[model samples]
Target chain A: MAIQREHELHSRRRGRNVAMGLILGGLVAMIFAVSIVKLSQSQSEDSTAPNYVPATAGASE
Target chain B: MADVSSIDTREYEAQFGDYVELLKPRVMRLVVFTALVGMLVAPVPVHPVIAFASILCIAIGAGASGALNMWWDRDIDAIMKRTMGRPIPSGRVQPGEALAIGLALSGLSVMLLAVFANLAAAGWLAFTIFFYVVVYSIGLKRRTPQNIVIGGAAGAFPPLLGWVVATGSISVEPVLLVALILIWTPPHFWALALWRNEDYKAAGIPMLPVARGERVTRRYIFGYTLLLIPVALAPSFTQIGGIAYFAVSLVLNVVLLAGAWRLLKRQESDRDADNFRAEKQFFGFTIVYLFVHFVMLLVEATLRAFDLSITALPIWF
Candidate 1:
């Protein structure tokens, strides 16, 4: 009975540790995905050549 | 069904499968599918990797809502024949454990969605969870006859949330998609309610057929079905849908309308063991109806994405 109780305690501790690891891993993945999206968005914005229509080009005289 | 008093968590140890059961995988599949349609139909291109991550977050959020719903409804669940085997009610998992998992997954899903997609998408996901878990499951469920009508919004919001995640904004297209689901839910659920009236009555849950008579519920089923036809067709006229979608919608809605008509024409006295075939058939068809329309939308979007002009509507349209 004592050995059984010890085994249960060991399993519970392992489960807690695994849960903590998953949470930490998810946080890291979230940060990484956010960084990639932000970076890609900024790069796209920068790459797009702005249309600079001359102010007077279409003005009627 | 075990009496709530007789449920003793100490008798059963939680298994890995119990946690999966808490997610309500069947409902999650529909949620994920609709959300995927929302994402795919958006005008802006989403990177496949980013899209995958966003969808995963949405799925997790939906699972969280299911867990929370099970937690909140565990008592009524214990009494109902249909829900007797759910994790909490079956005594496989403790209520405290379910609640903790629900809350944990809820926060994680929301934050992950916000980071991977836009905050608007995350906000909508958070609201969807809150609406399902709190507003529908807890607040309106036991109190009103119109519970399913309002509660339906929680399920409808996923596609719109998906659209917002992809585009980082809301638009008429997504709103129309949400509207379609919103209108469709009543007839869908009410049909099930008609079939499962005894379970609901036994649980003292005020479903339409329980609160109102089956006759009233049947009338509502037809009325909502009539209302749904127009909403289902609305998307075809918009920028999102084209000739292919219009043709699909026309055929599907007419069949759906006919199904409703059959239900309406059937007498309430016909709800005997041999004759709920109409109800069962309508309930089954409604699921197909929603899925087909959304899949057609995805087809239209894909056609447009590839510049496949053959399926495109005429220039005048």
Candidate 2:
């Protein structure tokens, strides 16, 4: 009996899968980075803008 | 019954590069460069990470549009010698797959841009994609001779989108960049249309040269190039331009003018064995013309940032 061998179709599929994996992985990394940046920027801007929260809270005292 | 097991899968082999080619990577480079310059030259500085994300979204949006264009124009693309080997037309990538990639990337880019950049920029990116895919590719291209003139706006929007990404609002400086590309597109595209007029005729694209006579086309190229000089020079007077920009603009415009002039003089009778020497030269110069202008603006902005004086420097030396 002859030994079985992987066909060319498998390699092409593997190539597509690997490429898709990289693209999806990169997108995840990008979204994570962008979210972190947005949060940090929001925090920085809020710190400089003044705190009305404490002023409103003092009325309850 | 067809032999399903015997069917060849070799023809279906599409590498990652095929998908990149589908996105029109060549055109994407122009978008990326112009957008980068737009961000770099904006009055307000963008954070590096934010800038990176912003440009990426814009580029992806541009790529998505290109893929959609390939999907829509697949029929004509197959006929045109220039585009026949393109992924969709050549069968390396399927039409449905191209459409899916285009739509998916378009949504991803617009959403990411809104989250990362401002809503205004995101909205503009979405509009740019729609304009390119719908307005240019579908609406204008087949129906009118003025397709490129109107469709050119789709290409010209990148710098403005980049500007919006940085400043979060529109302003004259970046609007100037937008105008620069708008005026530049006609001659840039028309010059190629003059040389590759055959391709346009074959593809039924109704390019300026195909719809109008070559003489009229040449005249238009000269006319637009004439208009381009002042528009290109206008930046030198504005904040976008300085002494360096002024001098460089003068030289580049003169060079482009000379080429456009030579092309205008050349007739169909002047084509020596299918060689559009003057037309080809003008087309090449137009690329350099847009590139150098944007580069100069970036240089001007960098100089201003560091407070270096171009006039004070030994420029000629």
Candidate 3:
């Protein structure tokens, strides 16, 4: 009975660890995705459309 | 302290599993699910990482409350046949150990949420844990016939906490969500209490059915079910829910009210011969009732987000 209980305990702990690991892994992946989305939006704005034109270009003048 | 050399390491390690069991994972699932829905339907979007961490914290806080409840109620748990197999009651874990783990996890979850989310959400989470452990479990549970009626607030906080995590502010919509849970709780729990009256009696706990008699309890259940209908429908009038949710809530509430009526009309013989099948079915449907409401709200939110909502009622309506 003691040995059986020990085995069950070990199994439960292993299951817990696996579940926790999956949750942590998913959180990391989501954060990475959000970062990519934010970065691309910033990059698109900076590269495609400048907020200001150069004085020499005379667009503003 | 006992000698380290004399301690049995293998037995000590096995006890760790029992500590997890004390957290009441089944209850934690509901806490997480409802909290997730709360986050999903909030007016402002939460960052994915913050949402994930906050929900995790909410679940941990819920588990912490469960552990603390178990720590406090080990004696009664041992007496009740339904709870006799719990970790502390079964001797798989010690009372002091449960208390320590509960306190530790309570602080950890609160601190983690404060760091990952806003202080308001974390503070609400802390209050929820305290309410469950101190106000409900220790104070009122064994003392009053209205224990579940008052104690149910602790169970209903996850959605409000989730909403706060997302928006850092309260609104009538989330307050209505909390109100829906508050009204729905009595009938949901009373149905279980109807069948489990024996367990409460054996444990010397003052549950409604045991204290006020089944007839009165059934009447209250029917009364609360009737009250829940208007509250559940009110959200659709607000911006939180739309046509799909309105239809769903109407149907679910009707079914649950029918069940409550049946439970109220059940003969004593029906309760005895069939073992309160009406009560049990009402309990089962109540779970479905609550879950489906949130799921429909989530669906409405998702649809509105994509500007594909065909089921949104006119704002004036």
Q: Enumerate the candidates' DockQ scores in order.
A: 0.11, 0.28, 0.06
Query: Highest TM-score, which number?
Result: 2
Candidate 1 residues lying further than 4 Å off, grouped into runs, are A1-6, A9-61, B1-11, B310-317
Q: Pairing residues by index, what is the TM-score of model 3?
A: 0.83
lDDT of 1 by residue, B4-65 (tens): 33444354557566887898989889988999999888877777767778888888899999
Clashing pairs in 3: none
lDDT of 1 at B266: 82
User: What lDDT tens digits, residue by residue, belong to model 2 across residues B1-317?
Assistant: 44434556664678888999988888888999999998888777787888898898999999999999999999999998889999999999989989999999999999999988888899999999999999999999988878888888899999999888887888777777888888899999998887788898998888988898888888988898898888788777776578899899999999999888888777777876558777787788888889999999888988998888465333221
Task: Specify the poorest-scoring 10-residue window by lDDT in model 1 chain B.
Answer: B1-10
lDDT of 1 at B252: 85
Compose the digit string of candidate 3's lDDT tens values, residues A1-61: 1333344445646755776677679757755754554343322224345433233231100
lDDT of 3 by residue, B1-317 (tens): 43334544445343345667899999999999999999899887876756787898899999999999999999999998889999988888878888998998999889878766678899999999999889999999999998987788899899999999988877888888888888889999889988888999999999999999999999999999888899899888777788889998989988988888898898899989987877888899999999999999899899889987775476532
Compare the candidates by DockQ and give the number of the best one: 2
